[model samples]
Target chain A: MKVHVIGIGLIGGSMVLDIKSLHPDATIYGIDTNESHLAEAITLGVIDKVGTFDDLAEADFVIVSVPVDVALTLMPKVLDAIGDNTIVFEVGSTKIPICEAVANHQRRRNFIATHPIAGTEFSGPSAAIKNLFQGKTNIICEVEKTTFKLQEKALDLFRSLGMRIRYMDPKSHDKHIAYVSHLSHISSFMLGKTVINKEKDEQDIFDMAGSGFESTVRLAKSSPAMWTPIFKQNKKQVVKSLEEYISNLTLFKELLANDDFDAIFNEMQSVNKIKEILNGMKK
Target chain B: MKVHVIGIGLIGGSMVLDIKSLHPDATIYGIDTNESHLAEAITLGVIDKVGTFDDLAEADFVIVSVPVDVALTLMPKVLDAIGDNTIVFEVGSTKIPICEAVANHQRRRNFIATHPIAGTEFSGPSAAIKNLFQGKTNIICEVEKTTFKLQEKALDLFRSLGMRIRYMDPKSHDKHIAYVSHLSHISSFMLGKTVINKEKDEQDIFDMAGSGFESTVRLAKSSPAMWTPIFKQNKKQVVKSLEEYISNLTLFKELLANDDFDAIFNEMQSVNKIKEILNGMKK
Candidate 1:
């Protein structure tokens, strides 16, 4: 099998590595507009060859792994370029836009919209790793639009990479991902901005940042180019989640101001239910 | 030398283990309001023995590691029970209240208000690990309050455990920590609450929680008993930091609602400065 991965950065590059590692006979082609990333991906041996758009015509599988905005624009082009028998899939955070963009394409049945719920804060081709999708969930949206053979191919590919797959509607996937993923990036970036703006002394922040701060602010280090588009594409749901998040923080502030120790403590306890939720996520 | 550690949970127990590991001949005594933690500390070999308030008189060094509210109240009692030559210190997140609570104590000169900014969300004796303080900063506030000899003792002990030290005023310490540490906890808890409330199907949350959400929400798993007191004692500063945080989120919401993509994208780019800040912290 031959797989063409476009915009080979963290997610795409890592997927290339995973596919190559799992299917040694499968040939992998990398595509990226960023010359430096292509160079790094080639140097890192993340792909068997760095190829151009022409490669998509012959690709058994074409994976769109770019910024959400670019994914929306480029996905249709890739779909138009691919053969009817070729399977095209996207690993974008927001599914609705990408799904809609390709909804009317003649080869729409050849496309599968998937988001493998896995990533590190780091970006670029150099950040890619083998088995990045192992033990993680890959959400497949609007599976009915995908041809049975292509869906089977995508499932086999994810399964071979050791990922569990779940199905959801594209709209529902966008809403759920906003709360679970997109909002997290915003909260982290804003928290980082808040602290950096207030604590001008870099040395003070260094001295005082514990693991709690590190973990909470980890997403702040994510690439702005990658996240900004996600936030924009999922704006409505992201806005809703952000409002509720702000409301929650404001409620906490009021509780603190009133010295309502019981309320403060109980609210934290309620939120602490996240422990069970996180533990569940681990499984 | 004899050292008594109060509240032998994650931070306290880890400190005991590190101290004992470094000073093989030092006899360490454990104390906690929770009997189970005290017993677990001993069974885990984190301390040489278990003791009560009476043990302070004989302790060459006394380390208070209880919750902030309890630390403020219990510190004075420990001071009253300790010898004039005893070197006392604490590892609370907030320092102003503890510093103020013991400001005029007769043995104030023997006390050192310190915050070792390191810990995981998990707590209790089982969470203790060796070398917790290695390569971490131990922030000592109001060092002038400590007698020269006791200061030397505390400095030497922290050095022995592979920790670097920085000195700051308690007021600045609490305010800075409120932004860097306290605000992070609230953000994490609220993020967890927002997601959990929005995603009623636990399976969706479990499947969709990528590393981004997991890292951002990790601190929500922290103990309420431990965090509640810190929030109560540092209420004012926490409220201020939280207000700034909510304001930032609100502004971002407006930008998103307006479809000001450039504004949204640029804000994230600016906030991406956190990557540099976090890189500096790692150094």
Candidate 2:
């Protein structure tokens, strides 16, 4: 099987590496608009051969893993260029727009909308890893939109990469992702902004930052080009989640201001249930 | 020199282990209000022996690592019990209260009020590790209150543990930490609550939680008992930080609602400076 990955950045590059490692005999090609990233991906050996959209006709599968806005604009064009036997899939954070963009395409059935629900704060081809998707959840939205054979092929591909897959509607996927993923990026970014804004002396921030600050602010380091669109695409749900998050923080603040020790303790106790939920999710 | 660690939970137990490993000949004693933690500390060999508060007077150095509230309450009493030759220090998140509480004590100068800005989401003695403080910032607040000899002892111990010491005022320390440390915990807890509350079906969260969510919400798994007092003590700064955070989220939400892609992208791009700040801090 020949696999061609577009936008060979973190997610796309890691996918290529993972696939190559799992199936050594499989031929993999890569494409990216960024010359540096293409060079880096090629140097890293993330792809067997670096190709362009012109070569899409010969590929058995084409994976679009670009920024959300780019994915929306280029997905259909990639679909149009692919052969009927070729399966096209996307690994984007937001799904509604991407799903809608290709819903009416003649080869819509050849496309599958998937979000592997995995990533780190880093980006670019250098950030790619062979087992980036291991033991992680992969959310496949509107899977029925794809042909049965293509769906099976995609499933086998994800399984080989050691991912657990789940199905959901595009709308629901957007909403839940806003709460779990998009809002996290915003929270982290804003927290980082707030701290940087408050601490005029950068040296103070450097001297005072511990692991807590590092972990909490890790996602703030994510690529703005990628996340800015995600926040825009799923604005409503992201806003709602952000509002609830803000309200919760405000109430905790009020309790603190009142010096209501019991209230503060009780609130923390209530939220501590997060441990149980997180543990359950791990299982 | 002999050392006695009070409340051998994560911070204390880890301190004991690190101190022991650094100075193998140093006889270490563990003291805790929780019997189970005491036993676990002993079994983990975090200490040479388990003892009571009475053992504090016999040690050359006494380390108090407990919850902020408990530390504030017990520190003065412990200082009263310790001899002038013994050096006493604390590793708590907040420093103002403890400093104020022990200000007028006769042996106030014998006590070093320090906040080592290091910890993990896990708690209890079992969470202890050998080099928890290595290369981490150990902020010594209001050193004026500590005697020169005792301060030297504290500095020597921390230096031996491979920590770089930073000096700051207690009030400033509390305020800065409120933004950098305390607020992160609240943001995480509330983020966890919002997701767990919104996603009624636990299975959904379990299915969708990626590394992004896990890293963002990791602090939510922290012990409420440990965090409640931190929010209480650092109430003012937390409230201010919380308000700013809410306003930022609301503004982002409004931008999203308007589908103002330019505005959204610009804001995210501006906030992307966090990457530079975090990277600088990591170095």
Candidate 3:
């Protein structure tokens, strides 16, 4: 099989690794606007070769994995560049824009909009590792928009990477992810910013950063180039999620101000149910 | 040496696990208002025996690992109840109130203030594990208040657990921890609450919680019985830290609302430096 990977960074690069393992004979071509990332992906053996847009015509499958804005612009072009038999898909976080962009395209039946619910707080090809998608959730939005054969082929690849596929409309996918994923990035970034703003002594943070702080602020290390676009593309839903988070924080702050220990305790106790929900998420 | 571990839960139980490895022949007594927890500790071999408050006089070292509000109440009593030779110390998250509670007590010199910056999301005797403190930081506040001999003994135990000890005043310890530790708990709890509030489908949360959301909300699963008192006792400092966090979030929200993607991107880029600080904290 001939496969072409765009935006050869963490998500796309990881896909290359796992997909190669599943189909050892697959020849994976890579593309990225960042020249260095393309070189790094090649050095890391994440792709068989670096390829250009013209190369897309010969590929059997094209994986678009750039920042959402770039992916939106590139989606139709990728469809235009690919042969009739080629399946074009993207692994962007926000799905609505990309889906809407290709909605009226004649080749829309060949494009599948996907958001794989898997990542670490690292970026670039070097961060790619084996089994990045294993046992993870993959949301395939507007799967009905794709031809049955292309959808099944995408599902085969998703299954090969050990992902459980779910179908949703692009709108629901964006809204749901706004709550579960994008809001977390904002919360963590704000947390790191808050601590950095208050504690001038970095040594103090180093000494006191327990596992709790480490986990809570871990997402602050995510790439701005990747995430800023996600938040911007999903602005309305993300803003709603952020408002809910800020409201919850405000209520807790009021409880703290009033020294209403019981209310705070009850609030945390109720939220502690997340433990059960999260425990179910672990493999 | 005879050791009495009060409140026999995660912290105290973990200490007993490490302390017994260091002083194999020492007898460890467990005490808790929760009778079942004491019994579970005994069953799990976390303690040599269950003991009472009256056992304080017989203990050469008293480790008070209870909730902060309870620790504040028990600090003076444990001091009043123990011998001058007994080195009484509490492993509570907040230090100011506990330190202040016993400031003028006649036996104050025998009591040491410590906050070992190590823990897991889980709690209780069953949640205790070996070497939980290894390569972790142990903050000893108000070191001058304790006698040299007692401080050295505490240092010996902390060293045996493979900890690096740093000394700070009670006020500074509470303030710094508010930013790094306490604020993290609040952020995580609020994040969990916010997500749970929006995603009515528990299955959706269980499906979509990536490592980012999982890590960011890990502390939300923490025992409310334990954290409620810590926040209550350190309300002033925590409120201050939380206000800064909320302000930061509000700014980020405004940036999102205005579609100021550059500002959001720059903010996260700066906070990404936390990756280095957190890296230094890892074992």
Candidate 4:
């Protein structure tokens, strides 16, 4: 089997690593715009060889894992290069833009739109590790748009990687993700900014910040190179989510200002239900 | 040695457990307004016995770990009851308010204000665990107010438990903590609220939420009874932190609305320095 992977960063690199383990007989070929990343991925054993879009026709499976902005333009070109039997899946955080980008493609039936809800704050090929998708949700949007043969093959591969599959339309996927994923990143970034601005004495932050602060601001460490495009592609939903988040923070401030401890307690107690919601999300 | 712990919940309970391990020969006595907590602590073996303020004279050390509002009234009383030789430490998140609460007490010299910057989102005696303070920061405010002999005893015990101590004025402690600790809780609670409000269909959240969302909103699961008093006690600083956080979110929203992806990328990239700050905080 020939597996071709593009943009071999964390997600793509991790996918190929796991694929190597699962399908050792399959030749893993990597394609990345960054020459260094491709070389590093080979050195790190993330891929068996370097390949390109020209090599797509020979691939049994093609995984496109670039930034969403790059995926928008690359998707149509990728489809044009793949054979009828070859299956392609683009794993990105946002769905609608890429879905629309390939919506009118000649080989649209060969592509599957996936948002694997898994990752760490770190990025890069070196950051990739095996079993990343294990027990994590993989939201596949527009599954009906793909040909039955390729859809079955992709689903089988994703299931083999131990991912729980959930199908949704691109619109709902983008909107809901804006709240659950994108909004968390924005909230974390702003929280980090707020705390950093106030605590100019960096040593003070290092000395006083507890586990709660670390966990709450952990996402602020995510790569801006990858995330900026995601926020851009999902701008409308992202902006709406930010507005709601800012309003909530403003209300919390007012509750504190007015010495309304009861209201503050109630607000927190209600949100405490997230523990159960998160438990459900946990693998 | 006799150690008396007030409000036998997470912090207090955990402290007594560690002290028991470190000083096996010492007697551990628990005191709490909730009768069941005392019974539970004894059952959990968090303490050897239940004691009252009347038994304070026998204590070599007294740990007051109740809510800060409760500490306002309780600190003076705890100080009044302790003998001259008995040292007292109030472990609460805010400092200046409680420091001022017992500023002129006859036994002020016997008390130390400390905030162990460590805890989980979980609360209660059952939530307590051993080694909770190991490799964690214990911020001691107004350490000078405590008698030399008692300060030596308390600092020795904190070190024995593997705590790294940093001394700060009560005013500085509260203001700095508002950014590192208090602001994080507020941000997590608000993020939880925003997501919960928009995802009226909870299944979407459960399926779509990733590790980032879970980590960012984890503090929202914290006990309201524990946090409400901290926020109330440090209202001024907490409000200031919240305003800054809200303003950053507002500015981020404007950047998004304007399609200024470069500025957004730069903003996140700058905040990414939290990686190093947080790394320094790691044990």
Best by lDDT: 4
TM-score of 3: 0.98
Q: Which is the better candidate, 1 or 3, if ranked by lDDT? A: 3
List of chain B TM-scores, one per candidate: 0.98, 0.97, 0.97, 0.98
Q: Taking the tens digit of each residue's C-alpha lDDT, what string does model 1 give over A1-283?
A: 8999998888888898988877789998988888888888888898888877877788998988889898878988898889877999989899889888998988899999999998999888888988888899999999998999989988998998899999999898998888988899999989988998998887788889988898888888888888888888888999989989998888889888988989988888988888888888777
Q: How would you encode candidate 1's per-residue C-alpha lDDT over B137-248 as one tens digit per residue? A: 9999988878898899999999888789999898889889999999999999888888888888887888888888989999998899999989888888899999899999
True C-alpha contacts between chains kept, each model in order: 0.92, 0.77, 0.94, 0.97
What DockQ class does candidate 2 belong to?
Answer: medium
- Which of candidates 1 and 2 reaches a greater DockQ? 1
Relative to the unseen true structure, what is the Cα RMSD of model 1? 1.3
For residues A1-283, write the lDDT of model 4, one tens digit per residue. Answer: 9999998988999998999999889999999889999899999999999997888998999999998899988888899999999999989999999989988888999999998989999888898999999999999998999999889999999999999999999999999999999999998998899888888889989999999999999999999999999999999999999998988889999988999999999999999999999888874
Candidate achieving higher DockQ, 2 or 4: 4
- Candidate 4 Cα deviation (angstroms), residue A36: 1.7
> What are the per-residue Cα lDDT tens digits for candidate 3 across B111-146?
999999999988889988999999999999989988
- Give DockQ for candidates 1 onward, in order: 0.86, 0.72, 0.90, 0.91
lDDT of 3 by residue, A225-278 (tens): 899899999999999998999999999999989988899989999999998898
lDDT of 4 at A266: 98
Q: Return the lDDT, model 4, position B247.
A: 87
Question: Residue pairs in steric clash, candidate 2?
Answer: B109-B147
Q: Which residue pairs collide, candidate 1? A: none
**Candidate 1 DockQ category?**
high
lDDT of 2 by residue, B1-283 (tens): 7899988888888887888888889998888888888788778898788866777777788989888889888988898788769999888888889888888989888888888878899898889987888888899988877878878888998999888899999989988888788878888888887887798887888888877788888898888888887777777788888887777777777877788878877776776776777777556
Give chain A TM for each model in order: 0.98, 0.97, 0.98, 0.98
